[model samples]
Target chain A: MFAAAALALLVALILLVVRALKGPTVFDRLVAANSIGTEAILLLAVVGFLTGRPEFLDIGITYALLNLIGTLAVLKYFRFGDLSQSGGEEPEN
Target chain B: MEAVINMVLLTLLVVVTLGVVRLRNLFAVVILGSIYSFLMASVFIVLDAVDVAMTEASVGAGISTVLMLTVLSMTRVEEAKPAHSPLLPLFVASATAAILIYGTWDLPGFGLAQTPVNTHVGAAYLERSIADTGVPNVVTSVLASYRGFDTLGETAVVFTAGIGVLLLLRRGRSRARLKKRQEERT
Candidate 1:
């Protein structure tokens, strides 16, 4: 049952990767990439279980954090024309 | 039963990959991508790595989708056409896929008790982890204590990424000062 599920996810990941490659827009690719990272975390955990090595769970947690930060940073950079310009607080100008 | 399950999983992986590539709408694509992550997490569960499954579900299917969607709200989800052709990516991706598929052959058969990985330092850690670290989860013990230094390094790296993002996203002092001066003049 689990194997089948994992297969489904692997397929999704491959598709996402292609989308990332052929993204019609940068955001489309970013979305795809973000999804892929998410899938990979799951994949890591699943594989760890199948292999009977539980350490992968930690890696998954770390990966999740990194993925979120990376996605947010990318989005922030693309917005406001300048990443240097922070949101939420207005510049005196 | 296992064979049937593996076959099904493998088929889904392929189909989703194709769908992701073929889809035109960026929103739909993101949704599909999320589906893929969710499925992958399921696969991990089947593999018997419960801890891993938890992380995947939490991180992959949960946080990632939210982060991406948030990013989507800020930018154009769909991409415009590039001036150049895209044949190169297709060629590269397929070639890389072929190589990775071939590499899987060398991996130990799943769940083999005597596999080299289980025999070596892994066994030592597994055996001693509970007694030494007083942690029931060997994974946690190994990550936090046996190889604590490596974890520390990894944390530092993440911190650096956070710092880098903060610095990059932060307004320069000059810009802030200029704005302040402008306000005074006004």
Candidate 2:
């Protein structure tokens, strides 16, 4: 049922946290953080169903959008020294 | 079953916090912080605080991570080694935590109808929210209508944060442009 699925998701979240914590490279941590966001969205939707409140799904959708924007922004900032930098040419690192 | 879930989530949160504390790399710490926020959102949902959970998910997991990473990009990715010993701070933190946990010992059991919060204002809200505001979601009615001023203040805080970030990041661009213009003129 929902409880079982939630438990599984919790396990996955813990594993992701472990990966994030033990990452030897920055990209590894970033990937772990992205996966954690994905798991949170799923957790929110599943919890909404378990609680019989479908309205919570609206918040879940918002979280998903924010997650996407945040990951892309961080990646872009890392690639370019400035956030407002144009994507036309690569900056010498 | 719910209690079990809550306990499990809370334990994971503790583990994540410990990881954040032990990790010296700023990038790992930021990632762990995001994971911690995700765990907290789930805990909030299990407590039936859906609105709080939503805010935590968006602000804590989403915005805070991006902001922290942005800071990392501007600074050194690796944390500096501390010159001082950590024992004194550890002792102080442990004492504070112990006292705080002890302070919670006298709180009423969760969800008890006879508790002051449940019997007093909560009862009134549950009874009158539908009739007064015609909103089926009592939380929405309470936040948007009944507590209009408080919601407005929260919105203002978010607006201020957005403006602050824009000012901080955009200033560099303007300065660079000014330097280029001055050089060209010379």
Candidate 3:
């Protein structure tokens, strides 16, 4: 069952990769990259279950956190040109 | 089943690599690179290298994607076209790849117990790591205790990289602040 899930995840990953590679806009690629991160976290958890080692889920959690931070950081940097800058008062594009 | 998974993943990785190479948009390249790292992490998990998979997931998928995007924002999104023919680089890369493939011919089959890697200090580490460190995860024990210096060095390298990025990016802000203070004094 876990193997089946992993296989499905891999298929989804491949589709994401294709979208990332064929992007006509930066936003498309960014969305694809974020989805890829989400799929990777799922893959990690499913594989851990298959291996009977739940410790791998800890790594999955870490990846999930990092993925969120990374995506936000990239988007922030793109908008503000610096990560330290706050977006609160800035006019939206 | 494991072999099937490895094969499919490896094929997909190759496809992604080719896409990255063919793409000229920096944003797309960064996205593809992140996908590649995620695939690699999954491969490491399938190979039972959980520690390696974790590191790859953190550094490769997370940090590298952010770093590449940062660089992309700082520079032109479209890659500059080369004036020269690509033949030379293509030849060089192919030669290097061929040599690497040839070198791997001597490697023992995957997970073979009698392989040199599995037979040497690996045995001792597996046998003693739990008893010495009281850690169930042998990889953690080996990294934290047996290879303490190496891990420390890696941490130092990461720290230095963070500091370098901060310094490089923060200089403009500092300069702007100094100019503002100078204008106020004038």
Candidate 4:
């Protein structure tokens, strides 16, 4: 039963990949990538349970951190010409 | 009993995924994706993995959607429905799925007693982790104490990425401050 649930998530991951590949714009790509990252988090947990290794929770947490930072970096790049400039330092009002 | 729980979770996951694919509005897609994550988190909770569920709810549903929206603000929402046929993806995805299912043929059937993981350090850790680590969550114990070094490496990787992005995105610093000020005002 959990096996079936994991399969469903794997399918969702595939859809995220599709949305990412076929995105009409960078924003679409961003959303798709976010979904992919999310699905990966769940997959890590589910797979860990299948293997009965709690260590995989660590992997899930790490992936969560990576996913958040990566999304921010990408967003920063899109908003500013480069990553450092947009969310880096503050401008004087 | 467990079958019922897993089935419900799987159904929710699939439905929300389709929502992610079929939604015309970008905002709606983001919300749906979060729902998808929430469902996945619930599955983890049912498996008795509380730590993973907490992180998924926080990072997947909370931070992810917020960051996506920030990125969205920097660009235009795609108004048109993407219409690519899923021929290649369907083939590839189904093939991968089939392989996964086949691999599970050798796996223990839904929490049997004789699984190897239940006999190794895995079991020892689960049984004794509370006594060894001050933290009640075994997941945290394993990550912080038993595998602390590896976790550090992962943290460094995250820090490096953050610094890299910070380096690349700072466009003269002056305008960035301006944007923040504008946001605050708005």
Work out the TM-score per prediction: 0.54, 0.89, 0.88, 0.56
**Model 2, CA-based lDDT:** 0.82
Query: Please, what's the RMSD in Å of model 4?
Result: 10.2
Task: Candidate 2: list runs displaced more than 4 Å.
Answer: A84-89, B180-186
Report the C-alpha lDDT of model 2 over B62-126, residue by residue, as the tens digit: 78887887777779977889999999999999999999999999999978788888877888998
**Could you tell me how far off, in angstroms, the CA of residue A48 lies in candidate 4 after the best superposition?**
21
Over 4 Å off in model 4, which ranges? A1-93, B1-6, B79-84, B166-186
Q: Is candidate 2 or candidate 4 better by lDDT?
A: 2
Per candidate, chain B TM-score? Answer: 0.68, 0.88, 0.84, 0.74
Candidate 3, residues A17-92, lDDT tens digits: the string is 7788777888888888889888878977887787787676877777788778878977887787655444573723
lDDT by candidate, in order shown: 0.65, 0.82, 0.81, 0.67
Model 2 steric clash pairs: none
**Compared with the true structure, what per-residue lDDT tens digits does model 1 show for residues A8-66?**
76667667766765667778877886786677667665555655666557656766775
Candidate with the larger DockQ of 2 and 3 = 2
Q: Top DockQ: which candidate number?
A: 2
Error of 2 at A49 (Å): 1.8
lDDT of 2 by residue, A7-91 (tens): 7987887788778777788788888878888887888788778888767787777777877876787678778856655567577
Model 3: residues >4 Å from true position, as ranges? Answer: A82-93, B177-186
Q: Supply the DockQ value of model 1.
A: 0.12
Over the stretch B1-186, how does candidate 4's per-residue lDDT look in tens digits? 445556756775776677577756665566555656656776776677766777787677666766565565566666475488778899999999999999989888777767787776888898889888877767788999989999999989978976774554454455766877899999
Candidates ranked, most accurate by lDDT first = 2, 3, 4, 1
